[model samples]
Target chain A: MTSSAAATIALTDVAARRGNTTIWDQGSFDIPQPSITAVIGPNGSGKSTLLHLLLGLLEPYSGTVEVFGSEPREASEQLGFVPQSYHVPGSDYLTVLEYVRLGKIGNQFFWRSPKGMDQQVADAIEAVGLAGYERRRLRHLSGGEQQRAAIAQSLMNQPKTLLMDEPFASLDVRHQQRLAELIHGLRMDHSIGSLVVVHDLNPILPYLDGVIYLLDGHAHYAPTSEAVDEDLLTHLYGCPVQVTRTAQGDIFTRVTGHAP
Target chain B: MIELPTVTVQENWLEILTADFMRQAFIGGIITAVAAGAIGYFVILRQQAFASHALAHIGFPGATAAILLGIPITLGMVTFTVVGAIAMALTGNRLNDRDIATGTILAFATGLGLLFSNIASTAAANVQNVLFGNLLATTTSQLISFAVFLFLICLTIAICYRPLLFTSISPEVARARGLHTGRLNLIFLVTLALTITMAVQVVGVLLVFALIVTPPATALLLTARSLPALFLSIGIGTFAVIGGLVLSALFNLPPTFFIVSITTLLWVIATITRPQNA
Candidate 1:
């Protein structure tokens, strides 16, 4: 575990609530820099709530939430976000290039396009393996391609850390693997860490360096290897879970069945 | 039986074009069309068609109040619509809340309009003109006012274009990017109110959708690019206005009727023939 001083994200006794209902509390964790971490929890487990706290979309009910030792809002420029779903009305007509260019929008004058904006947009798109697809309308792309386009848009901010909420949702296994590989590549090539909220962790399990799991109204953090224990996961999900290892030493977990 | 004008082109085309009323109608119609088309692009993109429709009704009371007070109807309409828009914007970004706020305000404005119209029976007779519009009757001052309103709309849109687009498309991301989304919402709604005010002059409250919604809807069906779609929307709106006016001159019919018909027809055609992917 990285010390708090070197952590990219640090939460101390953080408690989150929606209205009067507490989602989670007493959450303390330090996510090391340049690592891919999975945020796994059952439905309504407040996995998304945790991400919102980090993005400053929601305030902690108590305690403190910090990104890079500052309030999330203060360090927003260094962060990028991908929502669970992105659907813009009339965006069916928006080209990939136009959509990606939106990431560079800051508190700037409307008339001034950023200098070297075209090259920056192109570079971001290429980084997400969406080269030659810039001119295509968003509606024409497949689901996986659209997902990549979304990642490209976030990369336009040149963010040091990315917060993706359910990036793997609705994607097929092949696409999920591709996205997981992309996430890993970002850590390796750009030293960008990601905290991804996900339901199924199998596709991403092999690539994750750490895990933040929400269970029984509390968050627990551990290295991926330690977090993949069958008994711990069974307790985390309240179901029978099976952890397996491939010959290549990759680890994955599957929920075996519900408790009888 | 009402006499219908002969379909034959009896008047010289140049003579009709040179007439003062015709010139004013052309200029005023084109200006209103441009503003509507530009603002309508974002309106459609933001899925605020209901809010746009509600603002027109909300302006009715303002127009009636102006008539009773012996002020310019445009002033009253602008005053009420702008106020209504700000209220709606303050209701937060939730579509459900906005619709409820808009409907409640629309209901109150309609009641106010009725009360004002009944109090001034003579001026109440002009309410029909406000509802249906009388483009050919536009005075020089009204034309100039339309020009001014158009300028304001253009300036606001120019200044707020990028943020407005960003917020409308992906508000969460925009907020995360440090945009003042609430402020942008206020600016957008006010600009929408201004556009609706100008459009009400050409098409009136009842048929305002012709200028403000149909052209942009059709433009969206044709292209996915912002600039091209915007220009196409303006072009289509301009064509509908001018064509309706020309047709009205030929038939001695109401230009509003022709304008609505032309726009509706174009929307139908575009919808049926749109690309498979679109």
Candidate 2:
């Protein structure tokens, strides 16, 4: 048996409830070490809920979640998070530089904010392709640029693992490429393990290493290279689907009745 | 009649500065400005202004109760306000939309205020100081107390400002970063309770409203940059307060009315130049 210590996320029967209604129930997953995984499903399949559980933002009624071999809060020091509204409040009034500085503020909760935190801030902003827009107010930036500022905020602390929920929604094709490029570089440069929840699977097929196909309480796990084939995809999707693979290994999942 | 140096600040400025009442009014108004602007900024960010208003009204009953018992009223006011804040914080999911709770507590507190005032040696209408305001009557000792308390409150805000801002903007993100957002919220509310109690004593309830809302609201419009926004609001607030106090002295009217009117006018001019989006 392999040593289980290196696994990043291991959840055992995590359940979430809102008042009387249950949002997610008794779900479990083993997220691989040092890799990018997409937790994908149709709408309301608890993708975001699973991420919250991993981040320790939500508690389970009857389960344990070990993120990086510790409780979510303990593991959070090495964890970075981005949500759907990444450009949420507190960014509107702040310059791109000041917005990223907030990410470093968390480091001061246990220790004083170091004098050199500005260098870390600059490095994070540079990593997100926002070197010149450093002093721009977040409101002055386009949606894509604002998102890059948010990415800079998440990357400011140099977290070992990053959990992003829908970081690419509502962006044009150009910005999407820029974001993908940013992700690619961060992975190469820092080897930062990332789990991003995305609605459109096609745009992201180029970046994913593994996929978690969720249907109600059940889940199917597969490597992007192997399980993303024509037969395997249709079964997990509960639809007649076909995967048209280009000779260069690009994947496109088209519904059976639809013309490609 | 003695020719004091024919000076730089327009023509009528020296006469206003020479008046003793004008000086007192100016100092009092400035103190009121700093207190109100600082508290109101948090009130808007936390969306707790209505709760603050309710606490002000709720203080009336507690103050009246204390007066009837021949004791200091600030104790009852602070106690009830803290209770209300703690209750609101701990309710969890049931009271997610805060307005409903604020309204309910407001109605209850006002009714109690009315009841307590009614049973006094005087009637409900006679306690105008509690319902409206009476800033003109603030004594020197009261002013000194205000300065000390204001310094302490601002110091506390300075120490915890970032986390407070984080929690105010997005509690989920704050929680993820391992901040005790709920506890921090209670601590802030407690400080707010202390502040409202002190302000209620000087400005009265109605004037307290002007102090808490107008300066910060005007500041939010005048400046887009964060640090500059705060400084601009304080500066704008100082100008309004000083001018209002001068006018209050010359015209013999309530300082609160003058303060609000001038600040509101400033806000109007700002809105004309600074559009909705920016």
Give the number of the best model, judged by lDDT: 1
- For A1-260, candidate 1 gives per-residue lDDT tens digits of 33457457889999999999999888998887778999998899999898889888889999999898789888787788888876665556678988889888634547788689889999889889999998888888988898788888888888888999999889888888999999999989888889999887898887888899998999888999888899888988888999989899977888789875
Clashing pairs in 1: A93-B224
TM-score of 2: 0.83
Give candidate 2 regions above 4 Å deviation: A1-7, A12-30, A59-64, A106-112, A172-174, A229-232, A235-237, A256-260, B1-29, B63-76, B92-96, B121-126, B140-148, B201-203, B207-209, B273-278
Question: Which has the greatest DockQ?
Answer: 1
Write model 1 residue lDDT over B90-168, tens digit each, in one string: 8756888878878887888888888998898997457887888878877788888888988988898788877877787
What TM-score does chain A reach in every model?
Answer: 0.94, 0.88
Q: What are the per-residue Cα lDDT tens digits for candidate 2 across B1-278?
A: 89786423334646755666555556666765776677677676666777678667767777777656655555666667667767666653323466677777768887887777777866454367655555565556556766776787787677777777666654565677788887877767766766777667545665566667667777776655555666666677778777766666566566667777887898888878875545
lDDT of 2 by residue, A95-126 (tens): 68767887768424333677888899988988
Cα error, candidate 2, residue B115 (Å): 3.4
Interface RMSD of 2: 3.5
